[model samples]
Target: MQITKLELHTSCLQQQRKFYHEVLELPIVEENQNSFTVKTGTTALVFSQAPNTSSNPFYHFAFNIPHNQFAAAKAWLASRTMVINTNGKEDYHFEAWNAHAFYFLDPQQNIVEFIARHNLSNESNAPFSSESILSVSEIGLPVRSVSTTCEYLKQNLSINTWQSYEDVFAAMGDENGLFILNYIERPWIPIAATPGIFPTTISLVGDFTEFTLEDAMYKIVPTAK
Candidate 1:
């Protein structure tokens, strides 16, 4: 489902304004001293003020670009910041998936990634570049419910369920847009974004219409599948 908007809090506005808008190059919805919103597909994620928030309330996400423009996308991002992960890897070539991906850290240290290939969705052989961003590719939400949330997303968002294993529920939608809903217990250990954390992330895939509902309900926790 596309995330229309996500409202969360950040302790530092300067950093928030720069990272999402400047660094990641997402479009801004609105901005003030207290709050800011950035485009994530059809949805805009709004960030407010909060200090040392635990569970992060949000996890990590990815973006999809035209398969052919992988080189140009990487070059553009490299011009801004290092594309290497904290582990200093330049790219993760998934032989199993036939995809090439790279990651970067946001102002809040969220692991943001750019992927060159997606197994699902409308593909373009035209080539990828900064201008070829298809849409927000994947979103991870830290929730307590796995099956319950998956069912709700299936019924309302038209997301196709692919698998639910361990604490991760995998789904796909739109064009090559895949999301992983990470579910875990309430008490989560706050790990550094260096490698990222789990049970505390929500990803917005596809258009922004998915979050327009007043009651954007997602399940919390569910028993092991």
Candidate 2:
């Protein structure tokens, strides 16, 4: 399923605005005192202010990049910020998935990724920029039961798990986008941080059904034809 918008909570809105707008150079679509929304390719990432008692939610999310510009994108990112190395390697290739990816941390210390899926054929010779970011394609959803969560998504939304391991992790949805259904306390790959469930909502294309799983909700909405 394609994610049209993803709403997440942040303890500090000013910092988020600065990082996404000034630092990353993403365009701000709207804003107010307590929250703001930034355009991320086809998706709108909204960060809202959270209460002091609420722990800042950290997530592992990825952006799809043009396949031909992976090298340039990597170089551009490294020149601007530190890239997180997985097993002492900054760039990673998943042969089975036919994708390349690298990770970094945002201002909130949430793991952010840039990935190129070879199967999609998004190739370009132009210089890579924030605009080259295709979309917020993947989100890590930490839940108590992987099977139950996957089943719920299948039954309610017609979304299926792309890959899985019993009680460990499940990659749900297609290559263009995925919901990383990870078991709670499971450390996210290439990092030491364990997944945590903070408030989040995702609106998917072409479906208007809304449902909650493990306190996080998903809303289906219309997609532009």
Candidate 3:
């Protein structure tokens, strides 16, 4: 699956905007008083100010980087922001996924990732930069029951599980894009903090129809080709 756009809520709209537009050097394609859209390669990432609530909403999402640019991308991001350390390690090698990834937290403490899938043929000879980001590769979907959610998506969308599935976690879609279904209260990958499963809107190129998830916290829309 290929994610074309993702809409997420943010308590710190201006700060998040500056982080993406200035710190990461992504181009802002649209903006307003309440929200702004930034183009991260092919995916349009939209962040709108969330309504007042007791707790601030955050999320976990990832960008696909060139297979051969992991080191450069890590260095580039580390220089701009602090790369999250996992068990004293800054980068990780996922043997099962055949990918290397690093994590960071945005101003709102949203977990962000830059992942390089070695299995893909998207190696580049050019220097690594913000422009080298290919697309939005992953978005975390925290659910009460991973198995139930996985079944629902498979039945409704005709999407297959990427690799494996367990009671607590399952990855839906292909390497180009994925919906990471994680059990609620489960800490996100490479991080031990409480998970953030805020309201999200995902637009993608896929085979299924558009529908809202259980609690209306998520809206998945498949665009026409």
Candidate 4:
């Protein structure tokens, strides 16, 4: 399943504003004192503020670019700042798949990334630019536990796990339309649509058998009912 969009929250408006609109060079479609919108190729990446947010809900997101454009994207990003190498450059290449990419953190320390894969196709090059990302290729979520989170994904979410080592569970899309729920050990807070905070609850929560991220799940201590 392909990712449609991602909504994240941050506390640093000026920092995030500069990073996303200036550094990333995404076109700010909407803006105000509290929030802003940028084109994520085909999907839209909107940032907002949150109140009463939990460290448990914080996360980072990533994308896979065309292999040919891998160097180009990296070059473009480098032209902006050398911070693209915020993550370790030693572990950049995957020996198993020969994929190339890099990672960095937003002002919030949430890991962000861009990767290029040999197995994936570059055929679907739709109308896109650095400002407008096409679609969310991958998503990251921090969870307290992997097995319980995985069971929630497998049962309630219908996501199929491709592999599981220890604390992480990698998965692709099922009929529910999800790709790669990379679970980690950190926590994240949710922001609604305020633009400059980290305590907003969530956006339109809906019920779709197709999985529109309608009900973005949060980890809970199941009751002994």
Point to the candidate with the largest TM-score: 3
- TM-score (C-alpha, index-matched) for candidate 4: 0.69
Cα displacement (angstroms), candidate 4, residue 165, comes to 1.6
Inter-residue clash pairs, candidate 2: none
Stretches of candidate 4 off by over 4 Å are 52-58, 84-91, 95-98, 123-133, 172-225
* lDDT of each candidate versus the true structure: 0.57, 0.84, 0.90, 0.53
Sorted by lDDT (best first), the order is: 3, 2, 1, 4
* lDDT, candidate 1, 1-225, per-residue tens: 454334555556678788777776777878887878776644456677655555343446677776666677888888888675445457778665667787776676666678776564546665443345665666655545666766766765566775556555444454344556565443211234222233222344333232321134332221111
lDDT of 2 by residue, 1-225 (tens): 788888888887898899899878899999998899999999999998877625877888999999888888888888777899867788889887889999998878889999999989789877899899889999998888888888988987787888888878999999878988888978887787988878788878855466787864433344542
Report the C-alpha lDDT of model 4 over 81-184, residue by residue, as the tens digit.
65443233412676554576676567766566677766665633433348423355666544445666677656654546654556654444532223344444
Number of clashes in model 3? 0
In TM-score terms, candidate 2 sits at 0.93
Among all candidates shown, the one with the greatest lDDT: 3
Q: Ten residues in a row with the worst lDDT in model 1?
A: 216-225
Q: Ranking under TM-score, best-scoring first?
A: 3, 2, 4, 1
Q: How many pairs of residues collide in each model?
A: 24, 0, 0, 32
* Candidate 3: tens digits of C-alpha lDDT, residues 1-225: 889999998888999999999999999999999999999998999999998745689888999999999999999998899999867998889999999999999998899999999999999999888899999999999889888888898898888998655688889999999999888878886778777668899998867778888588899998764
Evaluation by TM-score, superior candidate among 2 and 4: 2
